[model samples]
Target: MKRKDQMIGSAFLCALLCLLMAVSGCQSMEDQNYTVPAAEKSETVNLKFFGNKNEALNVVAIEEILKAYMEEYPDVNITYESVKGADYFDVLMKRIRSGNGDDIFMINHDTMLELMKTGELADLSGLPTIEDFSPGARSQMTFDGVVPFVPTSISAFGLYCNLGLLAENNLEVPETYAEFLAACEVFSEKDITPIVANNDISLKTLAISRGMFEVYKGGGAEKALEQMNADPSLLAEAMRPGFEMVHLFIDRGYVDAGRTLKTEKTKDDLADFATGSYPFMLTGAWASPRVAALNPGLNYKVYPYPAQEDGSVLVTNVDTRVAVNARSAHVEEAKKFLEYLTQKDVMWEFVDSQSSFSPLEDNRLSSDPAVQPLNAYMTNGRSILGTDSNLKYPIWDLSKESVRGLLKGQSVEEVLGDFEAGLKKSQPGGAQ
Candidate 1:
């Protein structure tokens, strides 16, 4: 009886041991196949972008780029908003001041200057893409050796010539200021309008082209700019040569100041030039597409402004520069997006969609045929920044007003004096 009971107990113990081993194996198998719950995975980061370009093409292009970025980085989400017309700056300032600005925003050179004063821009020196930009573009976006913004596109201001009209008159495109004047003289003698002038941008670009070559070129620009910034009155002397050119245009009947003052830019002037009667139109390369669409058969080409004695100079402005907000909650993510955006292929895609030149060093020449003539000037370093942000006063506005005075029959000295007086009044605690 005792032997039989021992056998039974041993058998029971073996069975219990076997059951424990089987349970352990099952737990091991479950552990091997376990996965983290979807809810506990990495959190998604959200970003917002604001821009001033609300055109259909701009909206579509940016949206497509953002979509591609999101697909590449599945953990990120971006929202884009844009304001149109002149009210964009005001709205942007209000949002920033209210501490509710977007993570990334588009700014012009003037807005960049204003933002720098308030420490609103993030330091983008760490970005590798900064080195990929053209030297001129990088320099324009740099302040005290620190880059705060990334330029996306560069807009060139040039003389839009009616190629058919020039061919009809047996004249070639002008290459120098002297040749430009000579062409204008011939057109005037033939009772044809030399240029279609307007109150906006026409004189401003002309003065910039002439003044940049005559006064701002070489190494003398720094001291002169400093002195002019200190006392705005000095700008008259610095700008006198260009102003004289404006005066001469009026005096020679090359442009009718009275009619020009009444003409609307990009509307009246653009229409008149499309008629193929005027030989020249002083405008930005941005207008080239519109000219083509307006008069598809009109043979035209945009050439660099004929400002130099030996050759022409291209007046360029870095447009639609993207800046990261210093106060953004997702700063790292924002910067990463900028890095993606400025990649050669992505940057070219955006710039080409806008019909502007890429700011990249390796891709300065535009694919657009109408603006191709200005590419040589850009390649040879004959380009100058039309909108210089370092100036203390609003140079564009001042130029417009000064040119307006000239068109209204005010002498160059009188216009300069008026400009000085206006500056003094705008100073702190000066006049209302």
Candidate 2:
């Protein structure tokens, strides 16, 4: 009996030991090697942005964007330095050449090629957001398969009217060439200059509207633009109507050629328009805020320049572009800012505040009353990008100069001939 009892005790002890061993093994397994993820360390970064929005209102608009960006990225500090007028380009080029370029800067389609020659702008072609850009804007920003900048907003050019003056004059916004002439006559009868522009101005704005109207008259805006690109000289014939339209304005006494030739741009034109000295002015939507800032009580609106056939033609193109410097120490940070700017909410807000349009697949324009008149025109496909045709090439300079010569009393044939000559000279191996 004692032996049996001892044997039972020994069996009980073995079971307890097995249970303890199992528990200890489980504990050891729990304590085995494992890795804990390290927290991401976001380093503080500083970036410098150079832009040409010098007007007070535009400066404020830009500041709003920067403020929002900073809020989202507390560790990133960005400073914007505004460069203004014609001198801005030269100054920026000098800074870039000297290795002192800003981390990010603004560029334009017209100057993109020239700027690229310096080999300073970075290639952003690999960015995923690039696919979101408008076809025309993307083409303009790209060169030889390299994209140097991300277009921020699609810049549009049109006529700005003082609504109060139009109402007082009992004139409806002109839709036809004849209606436009009649309205101008009415304004002239009241002893008001119907149109005013800077000394550097010619019917270039009108020509752009007319040129686009002629090109798009047959329905395929894109196809027609491609043909013009294949052979840029085609623009000479297409753009002739624009010159004639300008001549009509001058001949009808609707505009005083001499005074227009004397008025200074930006300063004089904005002052004239703000003071209600003129009924209409040829300008861009980007300048609308500046006009308002000068005289907040003045009511104004922008519309496409009247076309002979539809009277709803608009000259719309990408204007301000932002790019990063290839040599920037903060390239990744600059790219992050660009990506942040591409967010739909962020992009549309900037476009609306600037009185501009979006270049994204989900395109949108400013909702401001001053810019609403253009909404219908844009939706109806009555607008053309300024980059369409030879305008994207060096031929643009000759085109502007030809318009100036026409304003100076040069014959249409002479001006057109000059353009042809200049176009050939600008081409490789065609110089004479």
Candidate 3:
């Protein structure tokens, strides 16, 4: 009897010991025999991050976010490097080619497709918490269901209507192209330079072209992307109507050709709109807050670019995305880092800090100032479509040259024809 009791006690003690250890292990990821990658197995985790320009993207936010991550995985060492938004592409390319690109990097929506095609980006197939992402948003983050990146948030492109300027002229929101023009005319006549755009040629071109193209094609960014990837031969007449609307704006003498030639920054246009009191500025939602700050209770309401097809067409932009180089020496660590960043807690805090809108679905939509209006756009009566959603790469890229030539002297048809030809040459078995 004594022996049996002792045996039973030993078994109970062992089981209890295991249960206690299991509970402890579950409590802290930090109390481990090894830091992630088991420092015993790997020598070191050298990571670098590249970010775009934004107030919340400043050093303080980056540091705090990374520090939180480090606390969870003590063995990792990360470095933060950034460039001005305008000069970022240049520096990023240089670093990437020199084998020093950050482990995690920011990518443009337009570039994501091209990058994925080249297979230089890591396949984030099983990223943590991706199941929590916004539904359609996944289309932007993936190339054919193969997750290539993790986006922090989504952005939007809309009209930053200067309500005060509109009120001064007794203008209500313009309901049609003609009304839009009339409102501009009033501002122009008053020497307010009705519609101001950033001097950056690309932005001006996209702002003017994106709206018209979407209205013309009757689709969003993804459909247009498919056409671009499919055939360059079919783009001419399809794109003609859109280009015509753009020319119509210039023909009215409302948009200043000379002004665009002299402009290199949106600041020129934004400053003019904010301080110069220009009646309209075609820009992203980010501009909405800045203008509000410039003139408190400015009575401004953000509007989507008026549809040329005379329908509701909203230009949606995806927020910055996190992509790892497939070629990176430390791909495992990099992939783990990307997955960690996508966690609901991590992403929410990042977006909260920036006050930028996020599409993460796990958490409730934000109610804060910066993100509030954007969140409303999702629920409000306004229709939303991805900006480059259906844009054919050729049509999208062609806008640059077409705008330059049309702005200079080329007839709209001639410029569009040239644009089509360029696309044809890029397609296989076409006239390269």
Candidate 4:
């Protein structure tokens, strides 16, 4: 990472540290300062996770889980090569290809395809019962015909509205694209600025622009997949709206693009939301625990991303995947471990225990109240959705670059043109 990006990350951590200290429930599943648990003596099991979850919190919780696992297995010596979310994939991929990926590894949705190609993932079929798991996670674990890992946790992006802010403003949460834009208008005129977004292709905005387009191109996921596989340019036209929306958000002031360089960090949003410096956040479920923990008494709710088309609301599940490396020396054991993690009993426990949503049709694991509204929205069956298939290898290598450039003032058409060119260059069989 560049020095500037590193500095931004540091500032983000600093802000989060201050907010977590002051907020009531900011402690992650475990405190980073805690000691490792003493489990039953077991063989040294070496496994590594490349996840970028709450870095500090995940470290302890993950260690604890391994401790419990070791208690049962009693012969596992787990070696972790964990990296914080900061430049996680960049570091993880290098380690993995060099024959150093953990016994098991965690990856973002974006890199799953390339990782799968290295034949490093283990097939998790019949290893665990996932019929009760969320389809989104199940599908993500499998690329093409190969099922690699188990679904552990899900991350969702939606509205983080401050009920108090709305009540004071005499406003109801917007239900359509127009209402949403209107709400922003009201907030901006009130000099409230109304939103605290990082503005640089991060969560909320990234979903609205890229991920949403991936899903909203609607009724065409399969086709889009084929198109990208054959000739990426064939799908460029469908991507125009995604590019336009990024520009739209900035032009309409839904996001202050001018401040993007300084605020493109999650910590910035967390700080503003906690201090009531901003009342609305266009983020994901990852922020839910923070809201609940920080202001137990505050009134807040999550809403589906508003859409321009009536009844055209779409959701793109972009995170939550676990995969095994086909080349792993302990592929069999890794398979069993991942299967255990996805068992209905285990998956639900993981979801509830961690305060998250499961894509499983099983109603047993309840949702975080903030995003419960999705149940009704999803139940209505009016939603057309898709997963973050962009992680499907070198095909999408240009994804972030194309989007980042578009957001940084390049033309949508030009970005797509360049993206198609890059896609052709990177295709295994070569573009048609």
Candidate 5:
């Protein structure tokens, strides 16, 4: 009886040891490759993205991109709404204050700077996509030492060359101010409009080009910015060269200011260009697709506005921003979507479809052969952001009006004087 009892106890001990070893093996496997069971996965997450891309083309392009994202991450539902126009920033701020802001949104320089100071945007420094941005682009998006936004596209201002027109005239694309002037003379003699005089095309582009020449290329960017920050009158000295360039165009009959002052830019300019009546148009890259759509077979290309004789300065700006709301509940998932958008393949397609440049150096958006001249300046660190100089929003308006004033027979000095005065008033800190 005693021997039988000892054997039973030994068998029980053996069973207990086997159970312990089995549990240990399971834990070791878990440590090596842990995954939650299917039942433990989270429910579908919905994210909202609000932006100012309300135009037809913009909406369609963005929707298509989002569709691909949804297909990949079926568990996520995204809603995109556009809130553009004068009250966009006001509406965005109200939503944030109400604790109902979008998971992600678009931001511009002025708005982004204000939101950054208020701590309304998320810090995106840890994102993998941050490593892919061009230094110029990354610096523009960063605020107060924290990156709160990333640009999706670069806004480049250049001349739209009607290659067919240039070829017909036997004029090569202008490489310098002298060449540009000579081209104008040849076009004028042929009774052709050398450049569109519309507000959207001529003035704004020329202003940016001239601004870059004076501020960035001339090495006055730092000093001029400091003076503007100190007092607005200093802008007049910096802007003189650019404003004078516009005056020269008017004086030489290269641009008809009186007609341009009264003309509707979008309608008149598009119709004129579509007829192949003009040889050149000055606009941003945003206008490229529209131009192509209007005249499908027109042979044209965009080149950086010849700011210098050597094509040394290109005027570029951070055109679009993808920012995450600091208070978002779906931060991780929103970040994932942002990451997806910046992937090389997706970025290239987006840039190509939108007719814009990518903001990443690693994935440099190749330019059309006609517009490739601008790329050299961009790659050589000779580009300037529109917002980086004295071209603040208010100053932009003043600059536009200055051109109109010059076209309407106002003297260049008078118009520039008015601009300086208006800029001073716009400064919140009071002119020193």
Candidate 6:
């Protein structure tokens, strides 16, 4: 009986020891720090970027920037897709509808406004990079006190002069409207085309350059725009001076209306100007490099449009704006990319590649000899924002159509009447 009892006690002791050991193991696990798996801790973030500038050089530059960013941040993977042609906006809209919009995207001023209305663009107001931009540039990108996009470059429209042709005619580059007209007369007498006009944007830019400062500047623009937005007819009255300037150009035979109306912008105009026959081309400064590439020996310079008698005004469009998608899953990562792009060296390289002016406050003056002359106007605050978002009406489209009417041999009054009619049609319950 004693032997059996001792054996039972030994079995009970063994069982108790095993229970204690199991409890000790449980406690050890409970007391220890939990570690996430390596894969879970280092999940990769993927970002997609969309843009419209699909030129070979632009693609290469963008890829280089993305590669450098990825090198600095290993876990981030960015895929860039650039769509060519006017179909880009359509493609972007389709993507957004399908819930596959890019994390970051390029937008123009008008598109930014449209996207902002739909809450598609992230509010980038308090970003550190915002302070880097000049006030004028910031204002252009701002709507209702919210900055929805960052402008990468400023697109300046100017008069591209054939210095060789100007010298041959004993005329210095025109600095005033009067001087420009006089130069045109000289070229007319010599049977040389004074200006290369195109069907697209030449007349619109001309009117903006001539009358933007007078009508839109000096702190009354907001009120004037409000009035015009309320009463569409007031828009024509405000734009009269600019349209009159267009009429004068046609009436003086400075530009052949039929030829100007038929010529496609940046195509035929660029080709004709490259032949060294036209003294001036009314186009954007971005065309300077193309002009050089077309004719390596062409002596040329880009100057502000001779819009004033005392001085010239530079008409600039803030362009190549980038915005973060508000619905992006990787919002922080997308913002980091924008901050990277805003760095001085990176921004400079990108802006220079586009042959555009930087929007940063400390932007360096363009080194291109052709674009250097307009630096003074930029520094002196004589530059006007050509692509304004303050106005409620579609000023740019209206201006283009009005100029088209002018090109079709309509008088200034007739064109203004058409402009008023179109504005009335756009009003609610006015017309179809």
lDDT of 5 by residue, 282-320 (tens): 766666677877899999887767656665356777767
Colliding pairs, model 6: none
Which candidate comes out best when scored by TM-score? 6
- Report lDDT per candidate: 0.82, 0.76, 0.63, 0.61, 0.74, 0.82
**lDDT per residue (tens digit) for residues 1-432 in model 4:** 699999999999999888877786556656657655677434465665556555344455566666667678765555555554436678878878788776677765556766766677777776647566656456555567766656666554566788888878898887776777787788888777766665433423443444345443445566566655566565555555656666576666766665654664456666667666565777655566666767677788766666554533535353457777777777777776776666565556555544455666564534577777655655464343334553343423355566566556777678778866776666676565
Over 4 Å off, model 3: 1-44, 54-60, 201-228, 262-266, 293-297, 309-311, 352-355, 362-397, 425-432
The alpha-carbon RMSD values of the candidates against the true structure, listed in the order shown, are 6.5, 8.9, 9.0, 19.9, 6.6, 4.8
- Candidate 2 per-residue lDDT over residues 188-224, each given as its tens digit: 8887779876654336767767765766665666676
Clashing pairs in 2: none
lDDT of 5 at 195: 81
**Number of clashing residue pairs in every model?**
0, 0, 9, 21, 0, 0
Between prediction 2 and prediction 5, the one with superior lDDT is 2
Show the colliding residue pairs in model 1.
none
Error of 4 at 298 (Å): 3.4
| lDDT of model 2 at position 1 | 100
Model 2: residues with Cα > 4 Å off, grouped in runs? 1-45, 71-75, 97-99, 134-141, 199-202, 218-227, 262-264, 389-392, 429-432
lDDT of 6 by residue, 181-240 (tens): 999999888777688988867878888777677665565677777777788877778678
Alpha carbon RMSD to native, model 6: 4.8
lDDT by residue (1-432, candidate 3, tens digit) is: 999999999999999998998887664555546555655575668788887655433356668778988888888988877775557766776777777777888876555655666676888878767777887677666666577777886656666676676777798877556677678777667665666654344333333443345433433545555665686545565566556765666676666767765554435655566674566666656555456556665556666566443633445555677789887888899888877877777777666554456767763554444334445445444444443434435333455566666667678779778877777764546674
